[model samples]
Target chain A: MNFWFAVFRQAGRNLRQTWTSQLMTFLTVSLSVLIFAFFYLIYTNMIGAGDRLSDDLRLIVYLEDDPGPEMQEQLRRKINNFDKTESIQFISKFKAYERFAEQLGEDSDVLTDMPKDFLPASIEVVPLKSLRGYNQIKLFSEYLATLPGSEKVQYGQEWVERFYYFTRLITIVVLLSGALLILTATFMVAYTIRLTIMGRHEELELLKLVGATNNYIRTPFLLEGIIQGFMGSILGLSALYVLFQWISLHFAGPGLLNLFNFTFFPPMVIVSILLGSIGLCTIGSFTSIQKFLKI
Target chain B: MPKLVHNQDPIEPKDIPGNTMIEMIKVSRTYAPDIKALSDISFTVDTGELFFLIGRSGAGKTTLLKLICNMDTPSNGLIEVAGYNIHNLKGKKLAHLRQKIGVAYQDFKLLSDRTVAENIAISMEVSYKKPRAIKQRVRDLLEQLQLTDKHDALTGDLSRGEQQRITLARSVANSPRLILVDEPTGNLDAATTERVMDLLTRCNKAGATIVIATHDSSIYKDGNHRVMELRSGKIHSLSRNNR
Candidate 1:
């Protein structure tokens, strides 16, 4: 028989012999990968959502007093000089009041008795795509607040900071779970390989006695570990893809998640994860086989 | 101290007549501190000699055989087999040495679940023999021992004599440079024993060095070969067959 063929055949036999436990080991690794990928997907989309929100970032410069025509032109030029603008609009005090009443709807009566000049006029600035990042917006807001007739500049600073930190936390979780997946995959592979060695103790000894090389004897077991890692990663990624598709389809319309625009891992990333997991399993298998077959 | 026939001029395996296939100098094996199995005994076998180790139950026959194959380490001494010093052998070197040596166990150490053909083919498979060649060799070995009908039978399902023949067949399947047999006829009938001996004799004549460790005198009684009789973990006498 071809040496490789026999080695794989032996591996198949071992897997079959301990199939119940082997299946459990496989599932364990898959679920670990699933958990890791779940967190990773969420982390990626959160960051994507954060970036998307930044793309639509608008900073409003509220004024203490309305500027004169010449002063308004001067303020516009100052804003332009600060950074490029997609569109700069001057919302007058009346326009601001109208918008507030429209937003309140039935609650408009609560603001009906308020003075017409109650709301302050503001200059709404929507920065260019490249200048919409948090730090850029923060710096631009600080600069805008100092503008001639500007009272304060705001882009819901508190909310953006909170969301940024939230994504940072998810990044941490993703990294932690990634390390966890590595440990789980390698440990499960090692445990399974060790069990197979124990079960075939007598058979292995006979093979050794019959002049089988350590390489020959352990090739099948190592192949078993590698196959387990490969299958587990594939299963986990497929499940994650299914989840991504279901979420994408069910929440297709505009919603909070729609802002996320979920994207599954690229093919390259998937291949890397698969190869990485296989590498971990190979280490596990090699170490366990070495420990058992010291001769 | 048992008589030792050490190599005066050790030579390469390719060299002629006086080339010692096995050279042991004051070999001793002890278990757990002081339980001597084979003590201060030594001997040498020529390139193609069929040698016998005769001893009673505790006579250290099996221990001596184990030491020769590097299965058990001697508490002290050097064992050189086919030119490799087995005492310190390891890794690929040890594997290479074992690949050239075939051993039959007293317990008929066959994979009970594997078929007779597979059991014999293992020796060849470990050496990377082609499938067709392995199949043909298995068939030939089984046929030689009158076990052609039992080719597909699991070793566990075979009779004692059949298992014995299968073990012997497996040991010589690779055409090893050395063959070590322990209790070759322990489970064999008279006729089966005769057939097993014939096959071994044929292998010996074909130039593989042979070592048989047994307590059964009937197997080596009238054979023209060297015999080392052991008593209580040491050699009692080393003599050539008189008949």
Candidate 2:
């Protein structure tokens, strides 16, 4: 316990003695972590948005003609046989026109001159969450087309494909930023420790001369690196949270952009990033101090 | 006693077998590019003896100290200190060996950023417990060395003589079994040199085996300690064995 206390005190002294360089390292690591977390935050929220949208996924099967009540019942049975559905409602041409009018609101008069039966009747099928994949919906659409009076099935395939690519791009960016963060933190920390070691070269030799073990000399520097990593990550996360709050209130709130419900990283991800940065810094310190402690 | 590292799972000192604090047989150290630092050197120091190595600056006095401290490896032959092969000791064992030993370097290798007390306290801090005890020990050594007022002064800010005294204080702070001194009176005036030597002599009388390396001839010329003269890395003569 005494030894550990001394090690910690030495580490604190090291940090204070080289505050200039240490500060630079801290800021650099913080910036790297912020960039990585920013991308990750967006990626996670995008995934959440995608999941919520997918759960409300609807496959509208347009009918060739208004099917009799018995045919509608049979079609419902067939759809159930293929896969369960949250709801399967049949909408007549009149109902479709009324719904379109309701959507248009002030422009409802524009559609009054159009014939009532101009719009086709359709069966709107809301699939269960488990059956919401693009391929599953596509297969279900194909099967729906074989129905007795079905004209075509539409599930906005092009839109889903586009969203998928956009999310993939976000994921790739997050990964690249994460890799850059690790490298930056590792090198910055290594450089800081190397400078400290060189500055205290004589002191280290003296310590060794007075019977200090390798562990005795290395512990302080190791602790210094760890503290840097821990503090830098926390600072970065705090800055990100501040920025998140600003954006959340000024942009994503109700009556604002309403584009996304932006959220900060979950507890697990935050813990992971903190642990990863610390581990990276330790490796950096470990590698850099090896040559100096050769004696 | 300091108990050196004082680890719970310590590798017990392997059957020391005798009171021989240091033993060397044909210990030769050859630097790179075929430069011989020490050649076929053999000697021994008993448990409570004060030994001196007198030589010129390039006579491998510092190199000898490094070898005994396990800071360097011998190119050939055997070297043992405190019963363990100095060359074979690695990792914790080597550190443990170093803990039981102390070296007062010729260069006054003090941490420039640390205070005088911090510098001296380090030796004991590594192997001792209780902050109050470590602090008291540092105070006692500082008083003996007449550095009581400089406890909080940075070592680099002090004069060369003061720094050298701090080095000596640190070496003996941990109460090591074997203390190696290089040029103990190098930067001292006559009065300071006498005081430094008296402290070392007192430590030796307290059961510490001491090996002092110096290039000074006048100081040890009439001392009653065993002295070995090193010329060009080989023992030239031995005299004053009236221990």
Candidate 3:
């Protein structure tokens, strides 16, 4: 415990002694962490939005003309019995025709000229929440088409599938990029700390001479690196929070916020980022001090 | 005391008697292919004995001190200090060995950024001495070394002689079993040299093994302690005073 206390005290001293170098290192690490957090927020938000979109998806199944009411009831029962179907409701031919007429405009004669049963009655099918993909929807629709009364099965909004795939791709890219950024930051922190240790080479030699262990000497440097990383993390998190607030205040209107909603990282994510930066700095200092301690 | 052998074989620390504090057998240190710093060196220093290694510059005096402290390893042969073989020592064991030892370099390697008191306290701090005890010990050492008034002075701002005293104070702060001094009085005046030697003699009387490496004839002329003169890395002669 005493050794650790001494190490911490030494680290504080180091910061005071070489503020300029320490500041530069802190800023570099903060910038790296900031970039990582930005992408991470985007990836998380995208996944969240995708989940909501998936739950609201609906599949439309148009029936052959004038299937008896009893057949429609059987089809509904069959859809409900299928594990993938969450809910199913029938839309009569008249209602479907009226809805299309409204879409075509009130003055349009297209719907008025058609026969009473011209538009096919349809079943609006909501699949299970878990089945939310282009392939899943296509497979479910094909199953519907093979049924007794379904003339055509159409799941609207092809764009949602494309968006899901795009988000998945972004997730993969963000993960790789975040890993690369952290590794690079670790090496940079290590190099900067190596320079700090070099500046105190004489003191280290003296410490060794005075029966101080390699652990004792290295602990201070390790602690120094960790502190630098922690400070950088705090600075980065604050900057990110401020930027989020600025965007939320200025560009928070309907269309803009919908595209990329800006929000502060949740409590858990913030804690992890803080701890991760500290851990990274520790690794960096540990590696850099090896060569010097070997001497 | 264990017998010193000239054979180039690793000596087990257990083979050495408990009373033998430092034992080196056929120790050879070579920097490179052609630079043979110390070759075929063999010696032993008993517990609580004051030994002096007399040699000119580059005579491997510093190298020998480093080897004893496990700061450097021998190219061949064995070095046993405080019941641990130096060649095989590493990590915690090596550090433990050094904790019982102290070395005052020829050049005073004091922390310039720290005050004289901090420099002295470091010696005890490495040993994990309590803060209160460390403070008292530093106070006692500073008073003994006549550096009491310079406790708050920066080491870098002090004169060479004062810096040398601070180095000595730091070495003995933990009351180590073996104290190694290299030309400690090199920058001191006659009065200061006497005072410094007196402090070392007092430490010796307290049962600490003392090894003083110096080229000064005044230290060995009296033959107060066992003296070994190194002529180009090999021990030329060994003698002791008729106490």
Candidate 4:
């Protein structure tokens, strides 16, 4: 206990002696961590939005023209019995024409000039939350096409699959980039601390001559590094939080929120930041001391 | 007791009783591959003995001290301090051996950032002395070295004489069994040198072995301590006076 007290006292003395150096270290660490946090937040928000979009995805099943009520009922039963089906809505040929007319607006004469039976009735099939993506939706559509009186089945599987794939690729890229940035920051901090230790080589030699063991001599400097890292982390976290709030307030539209949502920073993210800061500090201090304590 | 004469040869280990404090036999140290600092030197210091090593500046006085303190290893041969072979000691054992020996450098290597009391307290702290005991010991040493008034002053603020005295106090704070001083009075006035030597003699009386390296001949002229003069790299002569 007394040993640790002495170590802290010495660390305090070092901080006072090199306040400018400490401040510089703090700024460097803080800026790096802030950048990491920003990228992490973006990645997290993108994943969340992607998941929501995937969950709400719907499969549209177009149908053959003018099936009798009995055939339509049978089709509905088949879809309801399908394992992946959540719900299905039927649209008759007349309703499809009406929707086309609504889209044509005051130019409804353009649709009226077309053949009356050209439009096809369709069932809009919504899959269960668990059954998503192109493969499952394609299988369901194939089953629908084999049903009696059904000539065609169509859904937006191509675009939905492409969207999912693109988002997944983006998430992977973000994760890889974040990991690389973290590694680079760690190495940079370690090198900085090593340089600081080298600058004080003469003082260290004097301490060694006076009978200081490696631990006794190193504990204070290591503590200083840890304190610097922690302070930097706190500063970075606060700055990130303020920036996130400002962006959220200034850009409240769904298009912007869909890209950069601040609400995605869960409790786990805060824990991760804490652990990351400590790990960086530990690596920096340990590496620096390894070189400095060669004697 | 009768005083030994000048130029008398040191007693061989085979002829003497076993009460030696330090013994180096054929110790050779080569810093670089080509630069031999100490070449096959052999000597012993008995318990509570005051021994002086007089030599030129580059005659390896500091290297000898480092060897005895286990800070460096011999290139060849054996060195035993307080019956422990120093060549084989490492890590914790080396630290233990170092704690038993007090060392003072010519530059008065005091920690400039700490106060005089704190500087002296380091020795006691390393030895795991209790805080209260360390405080009292610091006080006692400051008074003994006539540095009581400068106890709380920063070491950098003190004069060279005062800083040297603080270094001495730090060296002796743990009551080490041996004191290795390299040019303890090199930068001091004649009066300060006498005072430092007197303090060292007092420590010798209290059963601490003293090994000093100096170019100052005046100290050996009036003292009864054994003096080993180094001409080139090897011992030129070993003598004792009856002052």
Candidate 3 chain B lDDT trough over 10 residues, lowest sum = B1-10
Listed in order, the DockQ scores are 0.35, 0.49, 0.34, 0.15
Candidate 3 structure quality by residue, lDDT tens digits, B69-139: 87688899988886668668776656656766878877778889899999888877776777899989888
Across residues B1-243, which tens digit of lDDT does each residue of candidate 2 receive? 123345532223344547788888898899989999999889888788888998898898888888888778899888888777877877666666777787898887788878999888888777745789888988898888888999999998999999999999989987888899999999999888888988898898988999999977656776688898888889888777552
Candidate 3 runs further than 4 Å off: A68-83, A98-118, A138-153, A251-264, B1-16
User: For model 3, what fraction of the real interface contacts is kept?
Assistant: 0.56
lDDT of 1 by residue, B147-193 (tens): 99999999999988888889999999988878999999998888888
In terms of lDDT, the best-performing candidate is 1
When 3 and 4 are scored with lDDT, the better candidate is: 3
lDDT per residue, candidate 3, A63-133, as tens digits? 77655779878887777666457788888888887888888895758656678677889888998887776
Model 1 global lDDT (CA atoms, 0 to 1): 0.85
10 residues in a row with least lDDT, candidate 2 chain B: B1-10
Residues B19-130 of candidate 4 have per-residue lDDT tens digits of 7888989988887757888887888899889999999998888888888887688888898887778667654455555666889877777878779998888876655567
- Extract clashing residue pairs from model 1: none
Worst 10 residues of 4 chain B by lDDT: B1-10
Q: What local lDDT does model 4 show for residue B49? A: 95
Tens digits of per-residue lDDT for model 4, A22-135: 777778778877877877777777667666776767666666667678887887788777755777777888888888889889989877568766788777778887776557
Off by over 4 Å in 2: A68-87, A92-116, A138-150, A252-259, B1-5, B8-15, B239-243
Screening candidate 4 with a backbone cut-off below 3 angstroms (N, C-alpha, C), the clashing residue pairs are none
Residue A110's C-alpha lDDT in candidate 3? Answer: 61
